[model samples]
Target: MVIEFDAELWLWEARRDDSWTFVSLPVEESEEIREMAGGQRHGFGSVRVRVTVGSSTWTTSIFPDSTRNCYVLPIKRAVRRAEDLEAGDVASMTVELVDI
Candidate 1:
């Protein structure tokens, strides 16, 4: 989900393995200009982080679920539960926009 107010778009973050991917947010250097020009400026932003035994990553997402705003990792072999990670562990994530 995306929060848009007077052209300003506020998107939450989503987490993947090594890097993060968002729906509409620009990650590539080439798209930076287009993204900045398309929307109004935002004051602050946040990225979601997931931590595992081996490593940690963070990403931004477009989800608006207040309870689950971030794309959490599934409980599996590579991705574990949130409780399993330590305080310092980190993950990568990104944020973008989603059209309803």
Candidate 2:
């Protein structure tokens, strides 16, 4: 199944020595995905997903964010350039839950 939404890209540093940028799935969207998954998840509560942003499409996983109580989509450096995405820039995204 395919899920679509819009969200702002943001930077996150899970570790002090490392940093990554991510796009968070809205609560409504995340809940929908969880319901569809039926409790299937990998480590860190990550749900495998195929993501599309702008002109790029790739496979990745969305990790749960307890603070926000939502899921976050990591945007790779290559994808950021291809999509011309920047932190704080709102982007229209499509996420397809994988291994369902």
Candidate 3:
């Protein structure tokens, strides 16, 4: 799945405790990825993907946890890269993290 963000809004506010706080950090619209892998019951699958922005490349993953019955993937590095990339996007490699 590839999530494209037009822009990210970062809002800050001052707290009553004499500290500054982040009010909002909005990310671009999210995209969904769906795939089925062969396994018994309790298994996991992970794929290493590469996200490219301009000339930079970041490694990422898609993890499916069978025990939890859910698939989750974090784009933390991609989000951070958004800071430097506005006209950039991501590309990924397909691989299995685990098979049981």
Candidate 4:
């Protein structure tokens, strides 16, 4: 399934030194993805996906976040640079479930 949404980029608190950035999937879409991805979860309950932000596209995994009740997609440095994204910025994204 393909999902599209706008989300704010945020730095992962635990990885502040590493500058790990991410965007949370919408609650409704997260629920839908959970249902659709049942029995397909990998390590850390992550679902593989192909993601697009601006002109950058790459394959990654979205991990379930119990604290937020959603999945979080990591934004790699390369993609961030290619798209000119930074923390606190609002990004329009497209996520497509893959290898499931």
- Candidate that scores best on lDDT: 4
Residues 4-99 of candidate 1 have per-residue lDDT tens digits of: 111111222454352332222223421442344344322233223232223533332222223533222222323334324322344333323322
Please count the clashing residue pairs in each candidate, in the order shown: 23, 0, 1, 0
lDDT of 3: 0.34
RMSD of each: 13.5, 2.0, 10.2, 1.0
lDDT per model, in order?
0.29, 0.84, 0.34, 0.93
Candidate 3, 1-100: lDDT as tens digits: 3443222222223334212211110122111233323333232445454544345445655455343343444435344454442213333322233331
TM-score of 3: 0.28
Q: Candidate 3's error at 67, in angstroms?
A: 14
Better of 2 and 4 by lDDT: 4
The 10 consecutive residues of candidate 4 with the worst lDDT sum are 10-19
Quote model 4's TM-score: 0.95
Q: Which of the two, 1 or 4, has more lDDT? A: 4
Model 2 lDDT per residue over 1-100, tens place: 7888888877886533214888888898788777877768888888999998888999989988988888898988888888777788998989998888
For all predicted structures, in order, the TM-scores are 0.19, 0.87, 0.28, 0.95
* Candidate 3: pairs in clash: 46-97
lDDT of 4 at 10: 92
Q: Give the runs in model 3 whose Cα sits over 4 Å from its true position.
A: 1-43, 65-72, 77-100
Q: Sorted by lDDT, highest first, which candidate order results?
A: 4, 2, 3, 1
